[model samples]
Target chain A: MGRVVVDVMPKPEILDPQGKAVAGSLPRLGFGQFVGVRQGKRFELEVEGDVTQEHLDAAREAGVQVLSNPVIEDVVAVYADTAAVQA
Target chain B: MGRVVVDVMPKPEILDPQGKAVAGSLPRLGFGQFVGVRQGKRFELEVEGDVTQEHLDAAREAGVQVLSNPVIEDVVAVYADTAAVQA
Candidate 1:
């Protein structure tokens, strides 16, 4: 099986009130020196085949289309294990 | 100023109860074909310097040390814009 990791984050120019709220709460959470924090989504998928660059690309496209908003967010893809490809 | 985006997610083998809850709620939220979803943290930092690879690396290190559990999660760093470095 293959694993895909996607990260979704708000666009830089846009205001992220949620992020600001989190940043504000950090000190209360005992986290210091963390000037700011933005909240995003991560996804893990277990596909039925070996992990390949093509599979990664297709999964990423699907993620952007269905799970993320392109206008105010960005998605990134990461492979869990490259061994499947090498094997 | 340069912007850094960090994405943190739970490791694959670990159980992501929060992610499962989010995934379970997606259909009710009117999102379909999204078999699963995981939650994570994204960080955007406006560092007071050109965003060199060194800067990115340093920020990533700091993030891992403070915000993430290395045993159960992973972090990624992305550049917002490369124009400043080219100029």
Candidate 2:
């Protein structure tokens, strides 16, 4: 089994009202030092068979084409076993 | 600064067309053993200041209220420094 992680974010130029609202609320959330809070979405999937680059690419393409709006969003696909540890 | 990760998934009862399509592509990605690929969305936010439970709670609430469709999706909020490592 393999796992895939997809992250979707609004275009940098786009006005993320949701992000802004969340950023504004950070102070209230006890993150008093936080001045900005940008929010995005994450998706996780478990593949039933062997994991391959082609599968990852196709899955990512599908994400860009159907799961998100290219005009307003950007996506990143990460294959769990091969993904670099986050910094 | 603090980071918040929000994962958004379509409700199990709802049809996740994008996820299904992505799942279908996994075989090509080299994940032949994978039979199911449920896709979700991930969002990462970098707070400019301190991080607190209240900030986390508020951020999570905002995500649920405005960032996602409650009827069609579910969300999970994780505070980076305190988040339990995924198994």
Candidate 3:
């Protein structure tokens, strides 16, 4: 199977409460080295066969159209996971 | 500043309703080539200075200890994003 990885992150200008909660907890948990934390979403899309260009284009479209909200989030990365394609 | 990227995913055996919902929506949205979808989390942890081995180790520890719930999620990747650092 082939896999495509899509990363979606909150826009820099937008507020991220989930990330804030995590950042708030880190210091209390003894991980004070971290100055900030931004939590986002990662998606793996499985394909039946080898991932083609069409699949990548479609995945990018899906990344913006479905996986992320364009108003508050940005599709940061979209690429195929070649290591995931097994013989 | 440097950034460490941590990826967390639902364990294979764990149920992922969000992923299932996305999978179900794909075909209806004309992305039928995708056979499956799995949704997870991506966290960007900011560091005060250059990324060191100590920071990487701490990020990995935080990945498992705080970022993910070992009960149903797995920390899949923890790495530095060299491209994100600015001099």
Task: Give the alpha-carbon lDDT of every model.
Answer: 0.62, 0.62, 0.92
Local accuracy of candidate 1 as per-residue lDDT tens digits, B1-87: 565666677776678887787677656655444455566676665555555676566567656775579999877445454434211
Per-residue lDDT of model 2, residues B1-87, tens digit only: 566666677876788887677667656655445566565656566654556677677557756875568988887444554333221
Model 3 chain A lowest lDDT segment of ten: A78-87
Cα distance off (Å), candidate 1, residue A68? 2.7
How large is the i-RMS for each model, in angstroms? Answer: 4.2, 4.2, 0.6
User: Which docking band does candidate 2 fall into?
Assistant: acceptable
Error in Å for residue A4 of model 1: 2.6
The C-alpha stretches of model 2 lying farther than 4 A from their native spots are A81-87, B1-41, B49-87
lDDT of 2 by residue, A1-87 (tens): 565666677766778887787667656655454455455556565555555777677557656865569999877444454433221
lDDT of 1 by residue, A1-87 (tens): 555666667766668987787567655655444466666676665545655676566557655775578998877445554334211
DockQ for each model: 0.30, 0.32, 0.89
For model 2, give the interface RMSD: 4.2
Which runs of model 3 end up more than 4 angstroms from their true locations?
A85-87, B85-87
Per-residue lDDT tens digits of candidate 3, residues A39-67? 99999999988889999999999999999
Where does the lowest 10-residue lDDT sum fall in candidate 2 chain A? A78-87
